[model samples]
Target: MTKKIRLADVAAVAGVSTATVSRVLNAKSTVATGTKQLVLQALDELGYERPDALRDRSDDRVGIVAPDLNTPSAPEYIQELVDQLSLRDYAPILLTHSSAGGTEKYLQMLVKQNVSGVIFLSGVANESDYDVRRYLDEDERQIPYVTINGRNPNIGVPDFSSDDVGAVKDSVRHLYHSGHRSIGLITGPERFRPAQDMAMGYRQAMMEMCPDTDQTVLHSHYSVESGGRATDTMLDLGVTGIICGSDLLVLGAIRQIRQRGLRVPEDVSVVGYDDSPLMAFTDPPLTSNRQPVRQISSAAVNTLVDLMKGGNPPRVPFTFRSELITRESSGAAPNQSQF
Candidate 1:
């Protein structure tokens, strides 16, 4: 008969507390490295097969949660992540929730399914939201999880997000280098970390490069319609260049600029983020910031694997770099009289 391996038995053999053993078994992040190793070794010595859930590669199902799939960037990143996981012999199951359902409900649902792990992308809960902590401390406390484009201090889950600050700074600096003095920003809702970081980067860049230009930041949903309205507002305010948060927004802004009989780069210059699919083929190729989707997705998968192995992943936030891809939509700021 196989010997019964209780939590206390593992703790005694490992010379640690029962709680520490439980933490290791549950894949919690607080377990120290030394204690985790001892507990794992104890489990090995006890002649008990590891729990199926804790065993690596025994299961191939991983849950991927995203806020919405309508946008280009989220879907692109999800596909990349899925591909990477498949290469590692794990099958990815996707779950999408709207901004309205709340992250807590979706998270609880995933937990109930006993998924091997979870990866969240652009969900409603952000680094600043307290709801993340509530879910982190709830009924199920021991599942390995990773978040993309979101972070929280109290929650120990690993995060993989783009270097949004650097991206925005580069966008601003690019416009400045092209001689745009009065620049504007069309951004997503302020609550989201990506939007907030981009806005902060714009502000920091503005303060450093063109302190005299009036700061005109317009917050809107990450949609083309909002971009149109934002473009109109910025034009009315005499902005010579606009840095939009997404390529979709750039499309809308460009339409609005043309509707008003103004030519891109000739009337007002534009820079966009997330050089999504097909952006290079647009009427005039989009000049945008390219999110490091491949890097972020790989890091997220690797972190989840580490957690599953009872390893403490990096505590520091992981931010992947972005690059500015210049195209025809942007140019030197047109003469102020052009508007």
Candidate 2:
């Protein structure tokens, strides 16, 4: 005859009460981590199969969902996030939305594989209009997730992001001090939270510093080509300084400016966001906002791990400050002293 397992047997082996073993077996959140480990060890020693949730903990796998690898900012943050996860003894399974079937399909696959948790890097959660019902619906199975730089609050998860508004405000101030009077902003679509913050900062700074000039703000996709098109409009508006949402956008702006026979910093000065690697090597170099990738990645991993271990979600999103890295791309207005 096959022998059946008993809670009393597990309790005796773990040196805890049957209630504690029962709690651990049921995957109760109240069970302490040490207590849970002890009960699991007892079950293992007694040759009893662990509950599915308990078994899932041993997987130590985390799913990372991000935008296309082609995007300038994607790779840097992804690399840091992977490093952080690995340092915490978790294996990262990277899934780019550019892949076949996109984020929804990959998310389901991760769930089926029983990943410990999922991390989203500038994914659908960052888009204001994207429908997240599948993830938030009560009828569906809930998955543990955390987001980096996410804007939407309805996703109901912990978010770690940069203080975009402050960064833009600082960048605008830098340009104004550089003698850029007719300043313009070229950023991503307003639907993205970061773009919205950038625009808000631009508007606020213009009102404070250049209340006499019209606020020249143009929204576009976060790409080099889009930046070029927006730069053309700014040039027509007599803008002598420009702030872009990303470093890639700044490159496009510079190209368009050169094509028009205007030199960067002489005809127009420029600033960029997301100071990715090797920005200093650009022809004139780049002056941009540096996202604190390492700190954000560490905090993101810690929060996700906590959630996987049954910790409560953070009440508010964690926002980190960004720094402006000044470089050659930014300078004084036309005929102005660049001091």
Candidate 3:
């Protein structure tokens, strides 16, 4: 007779609680990937057979392609996408693209894997420079897919993105009311649609509120170091408020502000986008624009799954607005700083 598999035994081997082992056994999508791997290894070591649900099923797999996983927002997007897919009885195969292997390689692999559908999360698909042809098959037939938070106009696929223009406009108006006339904008490269929208909003808002002031804007990579350099320039320009593209950039700006012996809000009020996880925990909790992450992820998964089921969703892109979360990082503008 085969020995009965015990959750407690597996938990002990995996160095986790039995509840965690149970969740893994039940194929719960909420478990972290690393924890799930450890549980599977524990089961193997304990001579237990794997659950049918945990077995490889390429037919049940949906591909999720995303940019740099190092970004703080990436994990949240991944987890939400995975959970939504799993709720519909689909498993997710995550492919994170890097400079060494662009998205083309992963898309080709997903094609060969026979994935049911694909969902893009803020990647080359959103950049105007990249051709949407990469998403097509050899005969030029498009694959069933959905994009979250950016779209290429060349491809008529279902897309869900935040209202980047409105977000920046709101941020600018907020700063203007706070007595900041000289506000600067820091965002990603112009090639990305979100950044372009933000730039447009910044120009529009600046024209409306501070007509005479120059439309101060700096484009930078979504990295801490790049954000710091951009902030240095804005500080030198004597801007009283700064709006950054991402929370990571805001962190860099905050650090740069301190290094200049200035206090956040007191010397240089800052606002961040993506109100990503842990923003509220920063030294001065970030004031940020909160993207509707869960709503967008759920919609993307549902739409893609529907497409896989032969249901036709409109090819038009859907845009969602963002909420400005006021926090400690933003305040009434201080007296003109000695630049």
Highest TM-score against the true fold, candidate: 2
Q: Which parts of model 3 are misplaced by more than 4 Å?
A: 1-57, 127-142
lDDT of each: 0.81, 0.82, 0.85
Per-candidate clash tally: 0, 0, 0
> Candidate 3, after superposition: displacement of residue 15 in Å?
60
Write candidate 2's Cα lDDT for 142-201 as tens digits. Answer: 457788888567666778889988898998899999878788999998888888888998
Question: Least accurate stretch of 10 residues (summed lDDT) in model 3?
Answer: 134-143
TM-score of each: 0.81, 0.82, 0.80
Alpha carbon deviation, residue 165, candidate 2 (Å)? 0.5
User: For model 3, what is the alpha-carbon lDDT of residue 131?
Assistant: 37
Each candidate: RMSD to true structure?
5.7, 5.1, 13.7
Q: Could you give me the TM-score of model 1 versus the true structure?
A: 0.81
Q: Cα lDDT of model 3 overall?
A: 0.85
Top of the candidates by lDDT: 3
